[model samples]
Target: MPDTPHLAAQPALSIFYQLLQFRDQRRKGGGMEAIATTLTEQDMRDIAAHYATLPAPAPQTGGDAQKIARGQQIAQQQYCSSCHGAQLQGQKHVPRLSGQSHAYFVTQLRNLRSGARADMDGTMASAARSLTDEEIEAMAAYARSLP
Candidate 1:
């Protein structure tokens, strides 16, 4: 099974937006739809706030150096930080990428690329459109290696 995302330290607005998407069936849920449906708007807001107050997850260790380097290069080339924040810590409705689970990140990227996932804006889809599978893997490795 894929690793679940560590919601701690994520932007509250981002979490709330995702919850709304899941609730509205605008995004692919993978079981989140039912849970989201049970939440009132206030419940979603409270959940987002609670998670945002928690400490961020620690970075994964022992990643391949080459992959990390390539991922960093790709991220810079793609200007990922322009929206995700300088250290990928995220802001407002944008999600934090630092320390995200590799499997989940990879899956999301692929889904974005293929239009299998719904993005609030087309930016993520556009950004992901040209990525090769290798680049996706490298990006995931880089994100996981962050502190």
Candidate 2:
């Protein structure tokens, strides 16, 4: 709980500013847009630095068993483990859902559910489309309960 949200969001804001600057420069006949479209080594370094600074969410335990079971059922039905791993530890190019901040998970899930977050494969968006808000909450809770 060292206010990781503020620190994590800074890079996102910086990226947004970088995008705006690139757009402005492109409008002025600058080729920054092409460069900006591709993620540079420095951009990857910056992102890695920010991720390293972030503390993993606090470990959770002792949630309603029935709700967790139901959530697990939904997860299985949707084959969430295919990308998230058997324990939700996450796979390459996928993010860890278990042990993530509840607020963060909720926001992202909502975005995915609503098609606000543009996913490349659209897998998450399609999975989320079938889930109700209550199911999302239950899923989040179940994930939080895991290590």
Number of the top candidate by lDDT?
Answer: 1
* Residue 89 displacement in candidate 1 (angstroms): 1.1
Worst 10 contiguous positions by lDDT, candidate 1: 1-10
Per-residue CA lDDT of model 1 for 86-134, tens digit only, reads 7788899999999998888998989999999979989999999999999
Segments of candidate 2 deviating more than 4 angstroms: 1-40, 49-56
All candidates: CA RMSD (Å): 1.0, 7.9
Task: Summarize candidate 2's per-residue lDDT along 66-103 as a digit string, tens digits.
Answer: 88888788778888877777777554555666676666
State the TM-score for model 2. 0.66
TM values, all candidates: 0.96, 0.66
What overall lDDT goes with each candidate model?
Answer: 0.91, 0.63
- Alpha carbon deviation, residue 132, candidate 1 (Å): 0.6
